[model samples]
Target: MPQLTQTEMFLAVLVAIFALPYAVWRLGRTDYYAPLVVVQIVGGILLGPGVLGAALPQLHATLFTPDVIAMLNGIAMWAVMLFVFVAGLELDLKAAWRWRGETGTTAALAFTTPMALGALVAGALLLLDARGEWVGAEGQDWQFVAGVGMACAVTALPILVLFLEKLAILRQPLGQRVLRYASLDDLAIWGVLALILLDWERVGRQAAFIALFVPAVWAMRAAMVRLAERDRWYVALVWVALLGLAADWSGLHFMVGAFLAGAVLDGEWFGTERVDRFRDTVLLALMPVFFLSTGLKTQWSAGGWAVAMFALALLVASVGGKLGGVALAGRLLKWPRGEARLIGWLLQTKALILIIFANVLLDKQVITPATFTALLLCAVASTMLTIPFATPALRQLDTHRA
Candidate 1:
């Protein structure tokens, strides 16, 4: 293996750290949340082995390493946590409680229907395309199937919030309902993923440990919230550090701990404004580094027919399952027809959360390089499709209500 010279490494870091923020800042002027992903992807490609290697081959080798990859994963997890915490902060717990009846039904339908459909679709794809007979640890069959199912059933609540805010609809009745549903959707999907991970014999014990660790950390957070309420900054620091440590100790990713900490402190220790400030700083600073890291790690050449089939299965299951389930639930619950269809479509958009979960599966070796790349492509495509499909419906509804 070749090592990068000191100069090359320093330049790579400088490009990752500086270039992303400048791009984000410029993008923020037009659409505060829209351009970060695009910019980071472009930045990564520019700094990555593909482009950089073609230009300055030496710098490329130095920047790619196990250590650097791990750092990128950590940063990605943190970015995800910050994003999820922001989502939690935006949740109207009160409204969620009020709509508990409808919300519960919608959530159950949304999670179960998509998950089951995704699993079935994935299984069929594996049978058709996969080489091996048994699809397990050796074959990577179960992992691919589960990954597709998860991608299909998942929703990025944070992205949904960003969309709502961009449209200036956060406080509207329909927006409020969508927000609450998205929150419930996230909780349900994550819980299901945790359960699925636990079912894996190799990592079952570790998953069990993390599951048990949640409440224990919640107890600690309960104490920290009381103490931090007195001195906000001190408490925030302590909370963040403790959360990161707990997640590490529990054999779970740090972002899980960060999100749980945020949830525990939500509405109690940190107010919306302060949380917003912290998020903006983190987004502007560390989040871009994380996305660039993912972009840097992604290799399109790894993809094959098997991966292509898996990605297609995920894309279809996610859209069809979520849309069909939500639509059915809406009619069954007697929601307005248009409103029901819109909700279904909106909930199908997958972005940050899908990427985060795909990384997790990748780390666990549950997804191959090719499969992971395909899933990322699927997420980007689905998110792009979402805006065009949902925007008109949302606008029409707004006009009707007015």
Candidate 2:
């Protein structure tokens, strides 16, 4: 047998990613709730340092040497950038604005409630940290606690889009309503993240980025509007790369820039089908790398039981907060009975966006690797709970209405 070269090893990873998720999706028939992406994420954790590597050190080292991991990270970063870009593009901010009163009420409640609950969880975790292993090295206390809390509040709009499609509501009025709330929350998520990540030494650079972003966005949007559809795709990738660079230089993240890059452009200009196919293709081809890389970062240093316990606590906060927040809105706005429960279940879905949020927190040293693993587990569980819980609730509402 030949020793596998770098390319060969990476190819094997690709094969595992594509094959394992599909296999699980097919065999387990988890399409309703877990979905293919969730399966892929779970598979990544299984293949990561905490699980597979711990169990089989020699094989893990052979396959995921520093060089291999670096190569994989490169792919994962780009894949996630594109994924985030598509998320920004799909954010129907115009719709959110048009329905400002209700959207604002719902978005405000949905985001802030979970955040408050998550912060309480974070505060509790901080108390149990005998060695200070749960928080970031450079991050201030408030930042770590609040960042973790915001992560709990997040909704993975991309995954939510996919989930709603599975529920046969993607194009329905209810789906659009859900999207509007999520979109507003998405903006707030990033905005608060920027504040949390502010670097005083580089404050000027960050300010300059914002100043330039305005005209840059205007120019870019104009170009996107003028270009042929064929040209827009390639140009859009270039724009993602460019804005991503600017964002990183400005003491913010490239992912934030990638989102801004797409946010500036109109979704209508790119055509819905094109946007859909591009997103699907990116997810199919590249996002597995992101998941695997994320898994590689997971560590069980906090003790598995402790991590699990904290994770369950966070999960309750996330689900309970989101549901409670939305329910508050439903009551205030006089929504039909049961609508709030159905909407709350849908809003609680979290995967890509929360993972992305947590990854940044980890990168900025706002959270420890063990804390990240706990949050990752929480995200997986929350996502898995969405469809199963929402489907019956939605049906009961429909039946009651009938």
Candidate 3:
């Protein structure tokens, strides 16, 4: 080739972003173990610095120039904000409240147990990493530990919904129960994230954002209710952008604001069918780029073996803690046997949310890229494990019922 123009290169990159993951996903029939989104994330990693960049340095360098990377990041930011906003919009908190006794107990235990175990793991890493390879430059010991802990605790609500739909149980009573539990934990996950991201220097701006957000949300709700459904969709996107900007300005991260923007707007306002289509359309058209952008950030600077080992350790904490906590909740709440295991496996599905959480931590410099890599690996493995584990559990549950 003589010389590829930037536009040509950018198109080439887009081709790679959609092509590779899809090829692997379809050819390998990875859907049983990993969904297309999961595969896209893995594709991102393979296309990223650690894998493809290592194997084909010049090609990687030539293809992912600064301008091209910037364009991808811009798209990725918008994609993720929309995804997160939809996630928040889908929170069935009212349902969670209706089943408060069970959902509350289970969600609480499921989240806190993994968090504590993950924190302990982080503390161990702090002790072991004599050169400080894991902690970020500006990170305090507590921040690093807490961030990793919270990452372990996350369950990607959107992914959970997809999994439930795949299983043909999205409308079933058990599926609704699981969604309630996940919804409660989703709220908690974001709350913990906000706490971790708190910036003392920007407290004034943060406070202002919080103070104004309430009235703004009230007015927005009023406006949304009066708008036509088509108009509401357009206004919602504007709201996402506005909140994202404000949140970024206040040091809370645009994702947080994006979520808040959606959380305040009732999903019922847009109709369930419409909301579902909106989410599915976004996933189909936008999220693959976000996954690629995410993968491009991965690094194995602390050694692949070290990161793999750490990832495995975190995986154990994430899976085991989730199961253990749910089991405890089952015993306390007197849930039917097999229910907890099924719930635990489903709740441990962490691919997108965990990746998003890790990205935020990396952005704030609270965790080094090595740590992010480890967490990313942990997230992928955890998500891949979910369906295999949950399928058998579901069968066992049905067998019990029969």
Q: Model 2 compared with the native: what TM-score?
A: 0.98
lDDT of 1: 0.66
Question: What residue runs in model 2 are displaced by over 4 Å at the alpha carbon?
Answer: 129-131
Q: Model 3, range 1-402, lDDT digits (tens) per residue?
A: 599999899999999988888898999999999999889889889899999899999999999999999999999999999999999999999999888988999999999999999999989988885437998997889998898899889999999999999999999999999999999999999999999999999999999999999999999998998999989999999999999999999999999999988888899988899989989988888988888888899999999899999999999999999999999999999988799999999999999989988888999998888998999999999999999999999999999988
Native-to-model Cα distance after best TM-score fit, residue 34 in candidate 2, in Å: 1.5
RMSD of each: 4.3, 1.2, 0.9
Which parts of model 1 are misplaced by more than 4 Å?
1-8, 11-13, 16-34, 38-59, 62-81, 84-94, 129-143, 199-218, 221-225, 228-233, 240-244, 301-309
**Rank order by lDDT, top first?**
3, 2, 1
| Residue pairs whose backbone atoms clash in candidate 1 | none
lDDT tens digits by residue: candidate 2, 178-291: 999999999899888988989898999999999999998888877887899889989999999999999999988888899888888888888999899999999899998999
TM-score of each: 0.81, 0.98, 0.99
Number of colliding residue pairs in each model = 0, 0, 0
Give the TM-score (vs. native) of candidate 3. Answer: 0.99
Model 1: what TM-score? 0.81
True-structure RMSD for candidate 1: 4.3
Output the lDDT of residue 101, model 1: 92
By TM-score, who's the top model here? 3
